[model samples]
Target: MLNTACLRIHISARTTTTSRISKLANSASLNTVAARCSHHAAHYDGPSPTIAIIGSGPAGFYTAQKVMRELKGTKVDMYEQLPVPFGLVRFGVAPDHPEVKNCQDTFGDVAASPEYTFIGNVNLGHDLPLPLLAKHYDAIVFAYGASKDRKLGLEGEYKPHIYSARAFVGWYNGLPEYRNLNPDLTAGDTAVVVGQGNVALDVARTLLSKLEHLKKTDITEYAIQALSQSTIRHVHVVGRRGPMQAAFTIKEVRELLQLDDVNFSPIPDELFPNDLKSLPRPRRRLMELLKKGSPPKEGASKSWSLDFLLSPKSLTWSSSDSDKLEGVLFSKTKLEQADSPESKVTNTDETTLIPTSTLFRSIGYKSEAIPGMQELGADFDDQKGTIRHDGIGRVVSLDTREWDKASLYCSGWVKRGPTGVIASTMTDAFQTAEAIVEDWKKTFDSRRPVRAGWKGVQAEAQALNLSLRPVHWSNWQNIDQVEKAVGVERGKPREKFGNVDDMLKASGASG
Candidate 1:
């Protein structure tokens, strides 16, 4: 998950393109997009570029959107590991934030394009080798976002009550990978979430929000049952840095504050600078909100607080219940400059402990190189957890001679080291699309033969006797309809199938 602080900059820079793209998405007409691409078509007499994008998340779809809008007759084959699409929008987003998922509608419109093909349930590295895609497409775009979460690296951090925010979010949102996470919210009444990101806040809020509020969203049924029985009433969002350096946005903080019957504990006045007037607008507003706190509610059984300048040291188990988490040990830290957001901090010998029954680590996300990326001459920066690129989305090939020939590129978190929000991803993806278009036009004479795209890939798979059941766009629609129909029965937005088999069955792809 990324921060939304850079959203305004992206929106302002691409206002015209976005407005037109919005109109095209609303219309969902091939002719409108074709008309927009006519001028570009006149310049390229060669066959339209056939691109294979890995992942069906916002980055992939937005990249496909811009390329398709600019390159007439271009074909994009999107590969997704699951039977369903919309990677993060479907699995990572908090169920309560439905507004953030409006981008899915645009993704749906992108799938409606005849030039776009959604090949779901196809794992490129496992189901089909990465090298095999090169024979069938002119270019490959890696848009798969970070799939791993960062850890606190503290002693006894992998105990039963400890979980990553990713796993918990996936468990509730119906992601197959973490469907069985089954977090024991009933373990105790207090839980500590280690991080100050929006995800940490999401976990805190979910533990405290009214069941009736979550019931109307697309959260899984099993998750709802577990949450209904949750005994958690207090949450401590712990961070290594002070409030000025916290990663959470003002909107998420404000939402948590406004939850009914949920009280927020006030921050110590000394933690903040004496004169807040010197801080930037966003920081000023957030600090003010933290200072003001939430209104007192009568009979408020749930409360949460921000605990800062505490670096996690170890996890303690309960004395009575040895298997259960008792609390987290933290070493106190002091910032070199209290008022500066980017100030460095040094840990002090003094330590404090916050008693708890559960813990969630939401430090950040990390991207790993897909197995067999080396087969395509692609590189991954292990330290940075990002695909090796030229800082502009073009994957840096091991052989410079094969750079232009390989036509390999990347976008989103995998390219930019998992940081910015959806708006930032869109901007990053659009820039990649422009780069591809420019390269295609520049290297037209040396371009490879016209590739058959998915058609060629399907033939190769059949020849290789690979066991693959691809869920096309129509198949996803069937699954979508069934989920929505089931939602109507439950009086909620939608009840996602808990596993891949159910999704495959709903998509009519089950053998």
Candidate 2:
């Protein structure tokens, strides 16, 4: 459990002293200062530019960081629906892969800055409407990631036992939405995860990790208990295309191969050629792992198998139970060469079936249209399932020759169509900030100063009947302290509060 002593202390009293520096100078210094002043004044004039970033994820924090760094004296506020911050890093990354979550440290640093204010438990389109934010802030950046999952679009895809990789990963990672979602893992010894990607690996690893092994991590108590009772033995990671086309990274594949008691085997040599060419480096490494077999002296309880060049056609039930999944029917496929008929590779479509109880599809992620956004004259691509943006992450109107609106922008998965690692997301955010700065430089005179503080904003929100219980930055530090204390009491890592109410209560928020 997390040590309570290690958690940082929380300070609740607000200080009137201005810790932040003001770049606003008198009009007399306007000779050369006018140019630089013009660039910086858009964010500082009248009331500080009330910029609201709509997510608390990596993209949102990084965007806030870059914007505040570039635009002097900007009162940048970030809103998140979750009680806590660090979206995927806190709730999506595998528990064992703590190193990947170092991004949270960077986010913590950004959140601590006086220039940034975090308002948690505020859903953008719910309690806070996009239109309201548009009217309130000079610029509103939507960094809400793709919260929805992609479907298989296959027969029986909606089978009760068949889960979405997003939900499965969320369940193990203690996402509040899926914390209570404990699927029947003991139904069958064999399991199948459709679609080859890092998400698929994450699902498989969570299903395979021993309860004891997970105890040391920050996995929720409920998740730990549920996984402790899982009876899964074999996990088959199936992909529609050949290994070369799989989306999983080399590092993830290596990690999976390193797991004890998990054995990885590929298709027969006749199915895959020894001289397979033009394969990506990650796929090649996966092939090498397959040939070498399991590592020496590993766990003896569970194993994972890899199947490529197969597409799920149907999900067949073995028993009469409507709530349980039985098996999956698959269609075998072979690679085809684009050049000539006599080429080494030729198209081959063979049919087959694999038996399993659990199935997870990890194809990809898609964004959903926010309510009132379209009503506010926002353009979105229905086919692409993302907001329509220019090359620089500006929301473009169909009638306008270019994006002239100063209030609307985006970052993260929503900006770039749900791809790339956290590092890549940071770079993408900086680019988006650059675009915001350029646009501000072009149109500086129109923006007005914002006059609102935490107290004033809360009072206004209350007047509007909005249940605005914001988890201030210091409040998070309190929750962090209490959670770690609870974890230490239980001799485990941090134990998250099951719901928002508990989190707020722990943070000393008044009823």
Candidate 3:
């Protein structure tokens, strides 16, 4: 979905191991950053520019952190639709992966700054007009990650027993939107996951994992109960291409392979290239693992497989019961170049039907432009499922000049497509933050009025009598304390509130 085309209307516009050490090192330099900001504050006499960030996810916080460090006396107001902050960390991330959420500690540090503000329980496009928000800030940063998932576009996709990977993940992770998903995992022992990404692996792993293991994680109590009754044991992770073209990483594959008592179905040796020794280290290792597979445990009751080169053609329903899913119909595909990772795949005449009652589509995630984006001279590329932007992050539209009005920028999945890991997101956010700081410095003028930031937005909302109760940083801290306390009693990290009302009440913003 990378828009490589140089549009005149433009309106607009990572590594794993070394990444972890760099983040830890970055955390230790907070004091130096603060000292540097103080020096900048002492020398600069211009009016402090206020920025409005449209999300409270990793991207928003990281962008805020960098902007505050680079620009002295800057005020950042981060807005979150949910009462709680930390978008993906709180909801999208798997409950078992607590280490991946260490970024929250950095976000916590950013939230502690006096110049930073968190406005939660506020839906931007619905609760407040986008143009009204724009009037209050010198720049607007859109960091809201993807909210929707890509569909398989096959027939019978909307039928029961079929679920998107995004919805399933949300249901297990306690995201309020999908709290009541309650998928019917007891239908059958076999589940077909249609995708080769890490999310597909996550679904397979969760289905195969013991309920007791999931209980120790922050997965909701209801989810744990539902999983306890899951009859799903054999997961077939299907993909449209060969193993070399899989979107999943070695870490995810290894995790699935290491699941206790869950055996892995060895991939066909023909699927991999003969000259594995010449492949890149990561791919070679992954191919080797797929070839080697996990040892069969004596008590193994569950199993999974990495099924490749099969495109989902349609869903098969039970002959006797039209409502019940029977299996998935897949068309066999042939890769143009078996050795190449980017090989094109073509469907062959042969088709295979894998009998299963459940299916999970794990294709990818998608982002949409917030409502009223047109008012700010921004446009959403519906086809691309992203806010149209210059490759760097500056929002572009045919209606507005490049430098006439308040700057509009985007980051993370909204700026680019929804891809990459947390570390990659951090890097993307930092780049956007740099662009913002540079633009602000170049445009700062004595005659220009200082932005009112949140105060202005509050005044506007009051004038309109919107009856909004914005959740502040202190409120979120109270909510955090409550969640953590509950988690302590539950023997888990944190039991997140699964609905907006509960979250609002906990934050004391129910009014």
On lDDT, the candidate that comes out on top is 1
Alpha carbon lDDT at 266, candidate 1: 87
Residue pairs with backbone atoms closer than 3 Å in model 2 (clashes): 1-491, 1-492, 1-493, 47-449, 47-450, 261-299
lDDT of 2 by residue, 5-103 (tens): 111110001001111101212222212221232233244332235577878887798787777767767767888888788887677777777655655
Task: Give the local distance difference test score of model 1.
Answer: 0.81
Candidate 3, residue 444: the lDDT equals 74
After superposing all C-alphas onto the true structure, candidate 1 shows an RMSD in angstroms of 5.1
Cα lDDT of model 3 by residue, 1-511, tens digit: 1111100000000112233323433443433332332223224455567899999987798789888877878999999998889987777767777766666777888899999999998898888877888767888999998887888887888989999888998898888999888899999999999988777877888888888888888888888888889898899999999988887877778889899989888788888899899998878998998888888888899999989999999888888988799998999999999889889999999999999999998887778878888888887888777888878888853235444356888998798877766655666787888777767776777766668899989998999988787999999998889988999999998888888888878887647
TM per prediction: 0.91, 0.83, 0.91
Model 1 clash pairs are: none
How displaced is residue 137 in candidate 1, in Å? 1.0
Superposed on all Cα atoms, the candidates' RMSDs to the truth, in angstroms, are 5.1, 9.9, 6.1
lDDT of 1 by residue, 1-511 (tens): 2222213211110122244443443343433442343344345555568899999997898889888877778999999999999988788778888766766777888899899999999988899888888877778999997788888898777779899988898899999999888888898899999988878888888889999999999998899899999999999999988988888877778989999988888899999989888887768998998888888898999999999999999889877876789888999999999889889999999999899888999888888888889888788888878888887888853245353344889998788776765665776788888878877776665445768889988999899999999999999999999999999899888889889898998898744
